[model samples]
Target: MCGIVGVVSHQPVNQLLYDALLLLQHRGQDAAGIATNHSSMFAMHKANGLVRDVFRTRNMRTLQGNSGIGHCRYPTAGSSSEEEAQPFYVNAPFGITLAHNGNLTNWEQLKEEMFKNDRRHINTDSDSEVLLNVLAHEIQKATVDISIDAETIFQAVTVLMRRVRGGYAAVAQIAGVGLLAFRDPYGIRPLCLGINETEQGNEYLIASESVALEGMGFRFVRDIAPGETVFIDNDKQLHTRQCADNPSLNPCVFEFVYLARPDSVIDGASVYSTRLKMGEYLAKKIQREGLADDIDVVMPIPDSSRPAAIQLALALGKEYREGFIKNRYIGRTFIMPGQAARKKSVRQKLNAIPDEFKDKVVLLVDDSIVRGTTSREIVQMARDSGAKKVIFASAAPPVIYPNVYGIDMPTRDELIAHGRTVEEVCREITADALVYQDIEALKQAISDVNPELTSFEASCFDGVYITGDVSREYLDKLENERNNPTKAAKPEDAGRSQLNLNLANEG
Candidate 1:
């Protein structure tokens, strides 16, 4: 997953994009980049690091423009190299710089098509680069003259939608023309529109979440609808069109269970509210199983699970305690690249408060258990803290399938619950008892927040790919490629920490 933001403003947007990227730092930490368009010239600086580390004051000063896009990238589809860092730039049929947030399921096929049919060559292994080339090619086909119009842009998007297969939300800056943003037909990823009314004129912002908009002093307008394209022209005029033949609302349920910030709202559903509802549902199940009475105190794993833990404790008539003290500096372990990095970071990320766990029947509530690396380490921590019995609970259902949309869970072997029963997984994690929220309850938790949202991309939990393209053969191919390193793309040299490319003019 990645965080992408675009702005069309009267004032310089370099600082604005930087601030917005800071707000979305939780979404991605692998790499960060910003691309700005000045007088139809694009200036870009990107590197494999956090947003703050990637852009220096000198780098920021060079990125001069009123309209631009920023991206914080988490590598789900490519090598973790500076070359793979986005906003990828293509200088054909009008310069275009795109920062995308979603995995393209058909990227390899599209890349081959681009090379053989479209005569376009993709330089990097990043799917975002392939996506950019596709957009540039479509725009080249759509435009007949030197200048392009909103109708032509929408037409190109319509055709592009027909070709690309995946869940993606993207923001692109078209030279001096406009800032464009669009979401996939399934609405599997979150993207919203915001507006800031300045003394000079109106400024538009599009981002991965609503929090970025509100944090940057822009009022949340609404979510960019599924398969809808919105363009903000050079004069700040807004034009919109439904670019897909058929569109549906199926935002990823993992966003509420874990991915998104609780304060943000997606597709008219409040993430915080949905998580609380999940707690209520999980509480009901625990009561049915007669496990509520055995728990003396309920403790959240910290941060994202706090809302659910609070509501669950309230429902179970138990005391809610903060047993783990989280380190503010540590990045989220779930999004961390490797198993070794994630395992090592658990202790560094959170410390156990012995007073809270000592002599207590501690029930620890986490958002979900993916690989069981963190859960096992955390359970051992509770035992070492003198807890009588450690009962682990998840606010979400078991993640038995790989999330191909944007998350990093790629293989069944990596998922603890993929081929194991609850008891088997509980034994593996070394927890005294394990209670998982039911799948139906998980869906109801979100639907209760917004009745209109009757469906979701719950692929990881239910193993149902909403895109209808992921078959058994496709999954097997993915697993084979991941396990066999020789089949995967070799990583570039790790000597340089950053790369700054001038896609347009230097001066």
Candidate 2:
């Protein structure tokens, strides 16, 4: 997943784009970039660093513009290379820059089909690159019939939409043409438009979540509906078009579970409350599964589980304790680079507090366990810290299947729980007892809170692909990309990836 922003506003929007990227940092940390049209000159500033790192005081001044688009990336489509960075620009036939969030399930097939059929040479492995190229190709075709105007742009995007089958939300700015944004048929990811209300007029910003808009002093107008295309011109006149017939929301439920920040709102749903309810869901599940009633204390794994642990403690009438203290400088343990060093990483990433652990039978709460590597190490830490017993509970269900979307995760073979039964998984995590929220319970916890959410993308849990069936080729391609991130991240990949690309670049 990635965070994309586009603004067509009254005031010079350098800082607004910069700040929006700050809110979007959680979505992707690899690199950040911005492209703007200032005084009819296309100004571009992209770096393999955080928004702040990329645009320093002197650098930000250079990006001065009234309209622009920016990106922060998490690698779902291509290897983490500078070449794969986003805000991908094509100066030919005029100029265009694009960024995307979510996966294209048919990416490999599309690439293969396009390459074999059209003899199109695809340089970067990133899907966003392919998407931009596809648009460029279509636009190239339309040039014969019409000039690059609003009507031609609309027709080109509309045609391109039909060919793609997957979860996607994207925004871009076409130099001289205007700013364009669109979501896939399923609305697998969230995109909202905010209006900066001022005496001069309303300034429009399109972002992945409402929080970015709110952070930038813009009141959210509403989310761009699923399968919808929005074009906001320099003059601020706006156009909306819907794509495909089957437009059910099916937004990634995992966004609340892990991806989005606590403050961000998706399809009108609260990420913070949803996590709390996931804990509630797990608590009830454990009760039904017949876990012992008298647990000494409920302890969170720190950070991710802290919120859920609070709810779990309340539901079980148990005291909540900070059993583990996270190393703030360290990123989430699961995403720490390589699986080979994951065992050692668990200790360095989190430390157990002896005060809370001594002689206590602690119920350890975590978000979820895909591969049991991290969980086992954490469980060992609690035991080593002197807990008499460690009862493990996850806020979400067992992640048996792999996430075909952007999240970096183990494969079906690597998932400890994929083939094993609940009892089997219980034995693997080595918990005295274990429990997880069921699919039905998860729906009960979150659905009504957001009426705008037409469908929930629980693809990871239910193995249902909302956009379409994911081809085996795409899965293989993703695994290959992960195993070997290209040495030089493609411009689109670097631009969209969230991994702090400057570090990789420096390395």
Candidate 3:
């Protein structure tokens, strides 16, 4: 998943957008981009790096505008290339610049349709680019004049929503017109609106998470509903419409378990509260199974799992200790490109405190175990740090199915729990004991916070694709394409380097 933010303000928004991206840096680390509109022209800067490293003073100076959109990308759909760094621009039908979060399951078919039927060229393999082109085409069709209004924009989104199939939350800037934001019909990804009452007028901000909005001093408005579209015009007026035939609110459960920041709230449920609830349930399960009898202390894997670990320790009446000191410099190992890289980075990312682990029976809690590479390394580190026994617990249930929505876990073989039992996975990770949260318990954790949340997009645990599109055949195709080395090794185009474009109706 990526992080996308857009705002329409009376003041210049380049720095505001940059600060928001920094708050959302945890969502994506591969690439960062920002695009702004000035005088009906777009100025954009994007590159493959952390948010702070990607944009310099010179780059920020180039982006001068009162309205803009930003994206921090985590490569899930396409190859990690500079060319795919987003705020993808299409210079037709009022010159649109879009930054998107989540993957398009049917991007290949849509790409073919774009070339054969729509006659629009797709520059990169990134699905965000395809989505942008599709929106541009629909807007072109819906418009009767050179100028577009909220009705035409909403109509275009209505058609676009029907054609697009995936868990996506997008923010797009329509040149001089306004900023537009929308979420998929299933609400699989998060998108929330916020307002800042300025002296000049009311400035609106749309973001993938609430933290981005709050960190930028915007008051938390309600989340953008599933299949809903919101447009903020240059005059700072907000126009909204529900544009889907049968919209539902089945948000991705993984966001609470691991993806989202603990401080952020999605769909009216606090992410921090959900994680704490996960810990409580997981603690009870350990108690039921008599696994808590020998545990001397509970320790988190660092960062994301801290909240769950804290609550779990409290419920089990076990001592909670910070055994691992995480290195702030290293990127998250889970989203790293290769197995070797992830495995190697685990050591560099976290170091065990020997005093906390020495002669102690440790219960190590992690958000979830996907490939088991990092888990294995972490377990080994604990053992070597003088722990008598390493009991591993996952706050989330076993991820047995491929998450086609937005997460990076693709092939079945890459998932340690895909065909393995709990004992088998424990052996693979070299943990003395392994415990996982039950699927129902996981669901209840979120619903406990907000009773309105009855369902979730939890395909990884239950294999229930809410979109009704992902099939066994589709999964097999994805696995084959991903597992094949040659097919996955497409090189980045030469001279594509970092982008600093000034697009001005130059299709």
For each candidate in turn, the TM-score is: 0.96, 0.89, 0.95
Give candidate 3's error at residue 122 in angstroms: 0.5
Q: Model 2's lDDT to the true fold?
A: 0.76
Could you give candidate 3's per-residue lDDT for residues 350-469 as a string of tens digits? 998899999999999999999999999999999999999999999999988888888998888898997788999999999999999999999999999999999898988877777777
Q: What is the lDDT of residue 36 in candidate 3?
A: 96
Worst 10 contiguous positions by lDDT, candidate 1: 498-507
lDDT, residue 469, candidate 1? 78
After superposition, which runs of candidate 3 have C-alpha atoms over 4 Å from their true positions? 485-507
lDDT tens readout by residue for model 2, 1-507: 788999988888888888999888878777788888876567878877667777888777888779998998766666677788778876655677888887776676778866887556668877887777677777777776535666666677778888887778888777777888988877788899888777887789999988898999888888888888889876788888775566777778778777788787787788888778887877777677776475899888877777788988898788988878778655555554456767777888898889898998888988878778888888888888898888898887777655765666625656677778888988887877878778777766677566555457775676655555653433444444555556432434433322111121122
Q: Report, for all candidates in order, the number of backbone clashes.
A: 0, 38, 0
Supply the global lDDT for candidate 1: 0.92
Poorest lDDT segment (10 consecutive residues) of candidate 2: 497-506
lDDT of each: 0.92, 0.76, 0.92
What's the true lDDT of residue 249 in model 3? 98
